[model samples]
Target: MLKGPAGALHVDDGGKGGVPVVFVHASCGNTTHWAAQLAHLRKRRRAVALDLRGHGKSTLDGGGPISVEDFAADVDAVVDGLGLQRFVLVGHSLGGAVTTAYAAAHPDRVVGLFLLDPASDGRVIPAEQAAGLMQALSTDAWGAVIAEYWAPMLAPSRPEVRERVLSDLRATSQVGASAGLGSLLTFDPVTALRRYKGPRLTVVTAFNQEPNSYQRLVPELPSMQVDGTGHWVQLDAPDAVNTLLDGFLSSTT
Candidate 1:
């Protein structure tokens, strides 16, 4: 466990040399989400995956609304604790927003940014829809609501993969999950992304490949859409994800 602003944060650090890479799982997810990536990347480079505050084995000590900036602080804690000078940042879903915030604030510290099926824009969630979800999150219907919201995203995933993702979401803290969604409403991905002028790549599923998506919004932003996968692209198609990551790492690092 590494000491973070919130509390003890769990981190899985491995491998030896080459450019270090830090993996941040999606909201309500843990380091296990990156098991395949870590196993594959650690062979040649230092690979580290951390459980964000209020998720996995990490502790959520402070109270009040949690913002993307707050999540970014967790990344800050991990990199500082590990004494990393510059490294690659990989995030999924909510984690993508967090990594973007971090890279924007500390551009010099992040050599490369990789987002996998991430929440790239606030516009993706309509205000009315966000409000309704927020209300449901405050009641017993939170779990059901979350499951419903994630149902379509898991359609292309394998049965076991889909079940495991749902199980993780169910086990997530209601407070944490609610706060995470709240953060998305206020985060400005375009602005944050513009602040970071570095090597970056956005990998998305068919769900986020819409015309108004992140890549479309920022035309110069490098991105790739992987077919036959869902929101958890990393888990649904580990081999493809690994291949893309390898290419990104090779070109950037």
Candidate 2:
């Protein structure tokens, strides 16, 4: 575990040294969420996953306001602490937003970016749909959101994956979800996506599912859709995700 501005951030930093990879999980996730990726890729690179403030072993209790800047800073702190001059930065869900912001802020340090089912762009859902999403993400669902979201947001093909995600989600700090999601609404994806030009790829679950914001990158952004999975593609389809991830890492490096 490493110390950040807020508190202790549980980090898994092991494996042979090569190009380092730092993983940031979704809003309601912890370091444990990236276990499979770390284990599979560790043999070749220094893989690290950090629990964001208020998630996993990190403490968010009574912490100051949480925003995209703070999230990005946490990532920066980890990178500096580990002495990784340059590395592959991967983010899932809201973490995608964080990674994008981080890459923008420190383009020299991020050799590539792998965004997993990040929030989209160019269109906002109807008020009714947005309300439903808010309701589903209510803190009350922290304990049961996994089951509720599994069928709708994840693939039925990976029940075990869903369960594992559920464990980490339930352990996340209650404040973390709302805080992170709030940033999703306010942050400017278009502006952020334009900030960096390093090798970038966005992975989604279905064809044409890449965030509309990222789509703007077009030929510039090489994206792959690993389906038979959901938002948590890394968990539902590790083999496919790893295949894509490995290729991206190799090509970018």
Candidate 3:
């Protein structure tokens, strides 16, 4: 366990040599979300994943509002603790936003960025919609609302994959999940993307492929769409995701 801003953070480090790949899980997710990638990448290069504060084995002592910067700090702490000079950063959903924030702040350290169904278009939600969602998250209907919101994204996933993702989401602390959504409300993905002028690839599920999505925001941004998978594309189609990772790593690093 590595010391994090809030408490101890759980880190899974495997293999050695080559530029390390540090993975950040999605909101309400744990390192297990990257199990497939870690297992595959460890055979060739160092693979690292961490459980952010309030998720998995990590502790969130303060139960207060969390921001993208706060989540990025967790990544920073793990990176420094491991003494990694340069590494590939990968994130999913909310974790993707954290990756963007970190890359924006430390572009020189991040050699490549890989985002899987990342929550990158923070500007899409209007103020009132964000407010309503935040308010709903605080009510007793939070569970129902969350389930409904994510149902469509999990439509293409297998039964077991859907159960695992939902279980992880349900296990997450309400405070952390709520605060995470709150942070995303104001996250400036465009600015962060512009700041990190590094090799980056975004993989989106068919469910999230929209006209004004992250890839569309930046016309030149490299992205791939994986059909027949849910938002958790990595878990739903591990081989495909790993194949893309291999290609990206080879060309970038």
- Residue 220 miss distance in model 3 (angstroms): 1.6
Please give, for residues 6-33, the per-residue lDDT of candidate 1 as tens digits: 8899999999899999999987899999
* Clashing residue pair totals per candidate (backbone < 3 A): 0, 0, 0
Highest lDDT: give the candidate number: 1
Clashing pairs in 2: none
lDDT scores in order: 0.90, 0.76, 0.88
Output the better candidate (1/2) by TM-score: 1
Model 2, position 69, has a per-residue lDDT of: 69
For every candidate in turn, the CA RMSD to the true structure comes to 1.2, 2.9, 1.2
lDDT for model 2, please: 0.76
* Cα lDDT for residue 217, candidate 2: 41
- Name the regions of candidate 3 deviating beyond 4 angstroms: none
Deviation in angstroms for 186 in model 2? 0.9
Off by over 4 Å in 1: 123-126
Candidate 2: 10-residue stretch with minimal lDDT? 207-216
